[model samples]
Target: MSDNDNRGDKPQGPDNGGNGGGGSNPWMKSLLIWVGILLALAIFVTMFDGRAATTGGNTIAYSAFLDKVDEGTVKDVNISRDMISGTLSSGEKFKAYPIPDSTLVPKLRDKGVAISAKPEEGPSMLMLLLYQSLPFLLFLGIAFFVLKQMQKNSGSGAMGFGKSRAKMLTQKEGKVTFADVAGIDEAREELEEIVEFLKDPTKFARLGGKIPKGALLVGSPGTGKTLLARAIAGEAGVPFFTISGSDFVEMFVGVGASRVRDMFEQAKKSAPCIVFIDEIDAVGRHRGAGLGNGNDEREQTLNQLLVEMDGFEANEGIIIIAATNRPDVLDPALLRPGRFDRQVVVPRPDIEGRIKILEVHMKKVPLAPDVDARVIARGTPGFSGADLANLVNEAALTGARKGKRLVAMAEFEEAKDKVMMGAERRSMVMTDDEKRMTAYHEAGHAVVAMHEHASDPIHKATIIPRGRALGMVMRLPERDSYSYHRDKMYANLAVSMGGRVAEEVIFGYDKVSSGASGDIQYATGLARDMVTRWGMSDKVGPLEYGEPEGESFLGYSSSRPSRMSNATAQLIDDEIKRIVEGGLDRAKQVLSEHIDQLHTVAGALLEYETLTGDEIKKLIAGEDMDRPVPGAKVSSVPKAGTSIPKTRRPNGPFGSPTPLGA
Candidate 1:
């Protein structure tokens, strides 16, 4: 099992790269130092020039120029009252002024031929220098800092072209082991071999078996792909290099490729290590197929990755593990032999798996003894590992909010409902008539599920508004099963249409409701699949309509086939219609046979706002009915008191009040 499957320790941040404190870039520091020096020079120039403010004119230079002009032999002289004067030198008059003693003493002894200075009131050269240079310097400093900050925030340094963006977690950092990862037994078994290979590569080498170059973990997000990779690192006790696929791409063209190279180099240095790339499809997408110019930086990075995986010397202990939900979108070359040769599917957890996941996450959380993880798992059919973990956390929060000390079974059920539908909109005001109608609609669904379908049982039926629905009837499978039988599909369709069927039978017509829109869509889809895909209808025979040619954008064909003759197409359409009408008829017939019971259940639903499968069973079997045979327990009803009566069977009449004695 992968180390991530274990939940022995808390997750820690990445290790400090040998350099020490938090890994700041030396280049950034050097750039900041250069900026500081320039800023200091600018400040010094401004401070010394404060003297030139009051003494308007070129203070030092003007005084010195006048000293030279005064000391020279004057043949011709010109002066104006406005302070415009000329220096007489060799019978030629030039503009001049009196020299100050401070300037004359130094220049006469220093350099000859000094220029004249005038007391013209204007801004000083130093003041102009300060005015112009300061803004430019300020702009330069600001721009430098902003760009540097942006680079740092982007997980790379400014001009960090060659650096790898992969986050490294040493063995000491990750505490999660195989025990934490639950539910994905197949994925764990496959990863266990990887751990074994990493621990002792020579064992395989002795048998002339080569370790897989890479393993691609493909599944939906939140299925613990990255966590599984971390588990491998923990188990193998090696450094784990982690990076997102998007980390490779930047505005620069070849930078992504450079980053890929750097990452591989680092992984090689760590030798007996694992490199986990999350969401690898971000870079490994099918090349030359995007809307923009055919040239893609991501494709280049992917190509470089291929080369790195194959071209380099086959290091015995190094392994590459990548994860992506959209594995179908990845480059074909990347999936070829020797590069991601093995694909492990991290599917959503089954009932047993979910229970195990719950047990793992529930360890830290204070849970009531009555809380059963299996019950919670059965309630959530399609929950992933992350979803199960979230359910536990949500249950804990719900418990705390209700002033409870520990998470109880009731809180878990509430959390499951919240996760499946949404938060209950208790604030949504419904009139008496509307509430009654919603109750009938939901009860209709529950009744059909209870009577018509023996495989899938009604979990809960509620008139409470949640998300886009005014009411909802949740039906869960008796157990986790992969392949759906034809009978089950037909039964599901009937249950889906139960709402509309009941409305027609009870009110003589259907009342158009936004709530039933999703149900209707589901029912119609199932009927269409029965005719075209599943071939459940006699008219369609046992032949599939066949999947469409080329890739479908929504994973289903939007355009109908144009090749078939009109008559044949009409037959197909009629067959689809017949299948749907037949299912609806079955639904109506079932609801009609138990019309009185449906009303009873609907009435209870209106009063209670929610009913478990047992409650529905009670209303259907009449007041004096015995407990039904065991099937599947849907949602649990709140116990009447501290003691849950033994009369509460898995599949039994609902609201069977607690027995007086036991």
Candidate 2:
């Protein structure tokens, strides 16, 4: 946590016992206000009652008061309309209400009792008005107090719906610099010129090279677009106005436009500043794309933004930086030459980039000496900067969970499995038969992938239930691969069919479970893509076919009216079937030829519930998999005898495939 966050947790008490300037504690202030209001009401009641001053005397009945007067015991009486106050001859004070009799007054005189007549004065009209309006005034005070608090907390008052929600980011929130950014060097380089323009615009203008008025950051999610913007702000050391695109939208027609005007007005006052609008696609989407008449609140806001960005008046010294993952949906006017002139693409990091990202995140973690960034980077092919950061975090969490002092490479491996495959489901229970079937199924995939020359090396195989799968076998490339060859595609198809083929060969065809549903879906998609998209099938010709209408990643593909006609559709299906069937036959032949080795791998999985590629290779070569693995400080090596000596890859057991015909 930051120091600001920590300071908020402690009390304001100090040696002087004064309230600290950081006064977010509202309850105390509210209590004082209420206490003052209550005291004022108390004083008002005391001043209005008048009877409170005469509260010391005892109250008596009217008959007793007259009797006292008749007995000449009453001294002097202060008589009002219905009540009388007096002191007895005994010198004690009393009050009473008397009957309305004219003769009583004369009788009082005969008794020599002193009588003073004064009618009780009712409250004045002004006092009555005050009494009636007090509750309403109290209610108004409460409402005003609430509104003031709202303004203080939200910066936007209760009705400030059209105010700009942009905030000026500063170093207090931990300023981000270019040194803190990694894994996307090209994107960083693209934005460095903007920082230069902000710092010294004359250097560029001397050569008649005007800096871009706006730069649009286009990238996939988690590709570090927003982080790059922050780095630019830190480098420039100028004012930065940051707001989300959603902040410029409202239900009212002109409210969004009003906010746009306000935001630009604020930006103009702080010239030479960068205004970053993240996810600009929210308000900058295509104007006429909607089903409505096309002029909506969002379009109006977009129109105002376009005019402000590149209107008749040049916004000199002010640069606009916007980011979006869906740049395809943005309006053309927003991306035209003068508005967002330069478009920068921030792609996912490559292997080298991943290594740099890992190093950056590793500084904050206590990593073991054996933790190699290259090894983790090679294991992760398509990971973005955000993903690499999460990998490091998950590794730390795994180490903490295991009660380890430092995060080790083993913890990273487990974290990789979690991020790539899914978390392990330890709570899932399986019967003995189910466990055996899963072991055999995964063993088939591992064995087939090991025997395929073009397929990637097997990383690990497990019968442990994870994610939605009862068992899974993962493969990782020796290095990142950008393109695929025909042999590699064929190998993938064959490897995908290994699990189903194993069940058919070991058990009966009827007993083969639905465990290979995912494999079938993957194979079908690859087959169709090979025939239609990649032009791999000569029978289907080199024509591009449109997307299959109702295809899902996990479900089968369905055909509909698309770019191809009915006859061409039937031919495409034929080519897909042929490719898939060929792969099926290849997997079946390989598994049948190595039936004994398949049992050995399956038996190991049944015993260990999981096995690495190196262990599987050892098991296939008749070596003891129970021996110490690589990188372990072992005193000795285990011996093994093999009927056929084999040369295997040292780190991973792959790249040696026997020809099917041979």
Candidate 3:
């Protein structure tokens, strides 16, 4: 309680001391108003006090007064050394002042006028007191008001520096219940018991079962960890305090710790509440990972958090829920029992979960009859709930752009393409040679992917530029897969190398463009991983040689791996090069076997600019389709009005190719 609050309770009627915790403080307002009035009064008295007193009389010149005295018109008189005053027989009171002659007083006496000397007086004690003290008091009041205003505007004062900045949500505020969150059933179920504990502890307390003090939600970005926390609070219908881990950390040495203490204190007041800390890895990183001395603020904050959790009784009803993607870097103590006792892993949603997530996000969108959530879910193997939501929003935007009333399957496909391969750069102009090369390159990828035993089915092939790629071939899985086998790895590498192989087969190796640079990098990484990490290399055996990343807060580098024997290192390099060479060989053989099909697909791409998996599969199956060839002379130089194959655009409905590798 504040000191002013204590004063408010003291029987001081109508003076709440500005501390009563409700509406505006009437007593403070009244006090301020009176201060303003007193200051104004002091100013008025200060300005007007030194002037001569004026009342009920007209003043005459000294000569006129002397003449009046000679005329015997003056009856009674009062005199001072510098000025004189008198009452005339005509019943008028007047004063004549600044008289240099001393004969005036005696003359008034000779005229039979009652005369007396008026005594000199100093300013009264009230005026003197106001003059001396009112200015100081006014200055003090203005300064105090300004400081108070500054404190209010800044949301804190020097004394309140240790207060927690966590935003408090009562039961009514955060209404995001479990029904609002989908795609993470396991995480939701894990937290359901926590909510039950908050709702009523006696059921568990009778069995001597103490509620877990904390649960850490670990997941990748956009995996809905924060949303899960909010749902728990909503289900429990209790007060909720949400704060970020970075909020606790400050430049001041003990500020973070102070905030932790203050936050705990607030939780205790609103007992049975949930305190959620998002992105806890910011402040919960491993201690001593900083500079030589380590970070005092974050460490201190973590220590205080540990103490707070340890001090809480089993039935305290305060649950600390935190979320972090980098759980590996968090301090061990933070993950130990009694503090973050349960670490719930929130993984990306699988196919079914993705379908449910899409359904939930689709509630607000006007989806067309053709839009199938299941089909989209099957295509999006690694989408999180947030990603699904974004996909639906993107689809809706695509539909709106085309002036459509409903979001259709075609729009969803375009949105998915935008999400995966990136937006198509239709404005980018490609030369005739580049266009032809891109068509052959992408067709090569489609053909190789179709033949690869472990590859997913081709969805679509396009020569239209997407993102940084000159062209792209999308291969989407029918269902999500958790692991890859050796054949699958080999197939992936071969598919990655197909573009360059196609270029080498069609045009000589010298004619191949640098467009295959990304493919080579991806294939090399895969090959290296197979040799060093996956144990696919027969010479390197099943040994894992990849170094784990270091977990230092200051981003300190780790020492190199123990040096391998020269022969062993050379063997590993040779195995990686051999794997890449094998993939290139596989791609070349596949392209050579189906040279006719490759040209056919490339011709179709040059004509349509895009082909669905069904269309490509039909063409590959030897269906005689009308295929357009790039640079095929129509009449020597084509007429200006003649249709250029690459210039023809896809219909406006989708306007972009879908993600499918035929």
By lDDT, the best candidate is 2
Ranking by TM-score: 2, 3, 1
Q: For residues 341-455, could you state the per-residue lDDT of candidate 1 as single tens digits?
A: 7999988887888889889889989988999877877777777777777778889999999999988888998988887777899998998767766776777787778877444
- Model 3 over residues 199-296: C-alpha lDDT tens digits? 78899999999888899999888788887877776788777888889888888989889988888888889888888998999888888876757658
Error of 3 at 24 (Å): 7.8
Task: Give me the overall lDDT of model 3.
Answer: 0.76
After superposition on all C-alphas, the RMSD of every candidate to the true structure, in Å, is 12.4, 9.3, 12.0
lDDT (CA) per prediction = 0.69, 0.78, 0.76
TM-score of each: 0.73, 0.82, 0.76
Model 1 spans > 4 angstroms off? 1-158, 170-174, 288-294, 312-317, 510-514, 546-558, 561-566, 624-662
Error of 3 at 55 (Å): 17
Clashes of 1: 19
